[model samples]
Target: MKGKLAAAMRNLGLCVALAGLTACASGPMDVSGTTPGPLSIASEGSFFIGGHDVHSDTLSTVPNYATSGTVTVGQVYVSYQVPTHARPLSLTLIHGCCLTGKTWETTPDGRMGWDEYFVRHGFPTYVIDQADRGRSATDIETINAVKEGKAPVTALPALFAASHEAAWAIFRFGPQYPQRFPGEQFPLDSQSGLWQQMVPDWIASLPTPNPTVPALSQLAAKLRNTVLISHSQAGIYPFQAAALSPNGIAAIVALEPAECPSATGDLTPYTKIPILVLFGDYIDQSPRWAPRLNACRAFADAAVRAGGHVQLVLLPDVGIHGNTHMMMQDRNSLDVANWVLHWIDTHVTAAAS
Candidate 1:
């Protein structure tokens, strides 16, 4: 029976063995073995890469702010340039799954990349290294705890593990359902797969910081303007975070972001903030692309209905191919950055007026 069950899952395009199931599985894969030093504050300047002044900054101190009773689960790697100008905005850049924050740098072609473009335009930009990715610490002890049953299987890490398992099950069981194993309806069967159902519960199980209230408080305290730029899968973080604190964020730029499944809740909270969504025409390559794009459309419509600003820009002649989700690496990435900067400038001006 067990063998038959396993065989059934195999036909479903699901992997029985969970990939990256280590204690370090929650974030991006860090195979570089380089440990970054403590964060610090620094000045704005240009770093030479390929014979050009690509705006860059050294690691500075982490911003000192009151924790919103949530343990900081991840170490955010901030590469920012504090530009000297009036009403300068600070941007937090979030990367997609399996990628590090370095993906935001300019390409070899000398076009201004996301980070460089923002910095050169006088916007301070910070990239977060989500927990278990890049230089961030992995919660190995937590994994061991859950596996040993010392912790609830429903704990955040455990939930995440289960979610991955569910994905694997679907992938493995999906293909066999109609052939090798017929008429067996696995509870995890769906095009969205099992991960969609599990992510929200996983996110809820994890420690959530009241980034909205505290981020707003921090902005108020510093009297600085702020915006969030999220790419690919990481897009969900800021969108949900902003939804949690809509009034705190000035604007949001979602670059080929993965959409939050509706089961998460009404994301209506974010509809009140200005949002500029940049989607690649090639988004359909991934299995999740259509669902994600649909989710983005719904969110965009909601934002517009709330009397908030929203713009959807589709990349011309682009499609799901190599590096489709990595807009920062695309040849036309600089063009997208330029448009984003202009959008920000225009919106800020409109807000002020």
Candidate 2:
């Protein structure tokens, strides 16, 4: 009877585990209600690359470029427009957690957008859908390996995706840390523990590669003269990957990325590269946004201290409507995009001279 009871308990546990897995597998909702408007490029004239016009108005003609077979988990979908006449400047934009590559484009309202901005400027823009989010395979076993003390198979990518600042805080602070919650001294560590427990199975389910070094080396080879543009939680991957590269990246544009744990090691490798950070002050109005902004500030400070060329743009008080985290979809996003393009142009010129 005892053996039978044990067997029943095991089955029950398995059922619960499967249910939890199913929950985590669910992706984010499509918040984009209306298609964005036509992209407007500020280039001197029309240019062509890979048979596509860099400043085309027709969105349907935009080529869907795939960067696959290089990474193990997902087929990276890149929407590209290469300028035929100009030297190709690659801008890879990485989305935040739960959000897809579509988040970088126009919203359902059709008022705000990004596609036209890059294409118009003669820059080839590529937006990435991180593994397990969009068309990427989710390896539950791999995640489990990390929680079990086994080194994860994919180093930089996994670290960026799975490692949250809140989790690291819990590991450092313990239970009483929450007594200071939401204010200065508030227990960020406690929140991290809560997030970990909330998604423990998902954390434990990630894969660990038998040989991480070679995997990273292969990833580096896949990326050439690329400028990494990351948003929110997704910042971890670009930062980590750029650090691993010998020449590093051309530049990085981080839009309100989550904070990095102190344990994550030095980010000084990217010191020579330009790092542009765009933060939304109004994000703090929502309870969900406060922690993320705090984390972003912390990470920005660290990157600057490490000698990275850091530029922090704090959004002004534009009233209740301004706090949205999806600033890329805002009409004013053009200002930010122009700034980024100018920076890239300057960098490219400097490299040539």
Candidate 3:
């Protein structure tokens, strides 16, 4: 009976599998080669998951239909592509605080993004817009209330929108706006493209840990044997998700996370998975990022001592340098992505074999 119940639960989780007919084709990526082979995809689609209805007080003066419950907030948007020859593990890419899943779509200078590269490499790639961010719907009940005078000024949600100047320091583009760290791999000529991707972050209004963390856990079950690849603000979600539900999570690749799980936190979930925590260059220079790197190293050490499979890779140590906080979008983005793919093949796939 217990086994049957588990099977039913798994089936229920997978019921939301890719609802796609969007065509895709790419041969496995060859970073070293001059060209990539033709691509082929068996399925590709997009869908939303894990949202709760946020019914606002029926206020007058708004559009007639909107005066009714108004919105379904917190549901996450996911788009996926499954290759013709899929691998044993699928990948789910999560964007950071201000950006959307478009982070993985293309480089600012118009290079192939990691999403396509991974999909072409035979891992079904899934990318998500976190709850109340990016393509995900926002909870505008408060916005409606304020405009209608139904709520006080103080009742307004504090939304955070990052300016390009602030993003310069935050994303490690340079010491300041309009400056460049020598050899910085960020494509400076197309920086306006990066700013275009920024949007207002609704983190202040969303629940702690956000709906996206739980949604990630659910996605793991749906994708089955998945690797959760996260960056910057999303660095911790995969760990948090794995903590909640370890089943179906095969590995984790965290790229320059804002913070790593505490070295003292419960680490049982990590013992069962292969984990990679990677950081880019310029840590010692920036007081902000240096601590984060230290924290991850401490966490990695603790996880390793506890018999968990964890590796913390510093980019410069591997001879790849000049990466900023946004390493995945750097000039050497594909180089970084290819290195990760190689790591997956070596650690995850080879171990499974």
Which one is best on lDDT? 3
lDDT for each candidate structure = 0.49, 0.47, 0.83
In model 2, which regions exceed 4 Å deviation? 1-75, 139-205, 208-223, 246-248, 261-264, 284-292, 317-323, 346-353
RMSD of 2: 20.9
Candidates arranged by TM-score, highest first:
3, 1, 2
lDDT of 3: 0.83
How many residue-pair clashes does candidate 3 contain? 5
Best-to-worst ranking by lDDT: 3, 1, 2
**Candidate 3, superposed: residue stretches over 4 Å from native:** 1-37, 58-61, 349-353
Structural RMSD, model 1: 19.5
| Residue pairs with clashing backbones, model 3 | 25-39, 25-40, 26-39, 26-40, 27-39
Q: Model 1: runs farther than 4 Å from truth?
A: 1-75, 106-112, 143-223, 260-268, 284-286, 317-323, 350-353
Against the correct fold, how does model 3 do in TM-score? 0.88
Better of 1 and 3 by lDDT: 3
lDDT of 2 by residue, 80-159 (tens): 55533234456667776545666666543443356545653445565554544444434333334444455455632333
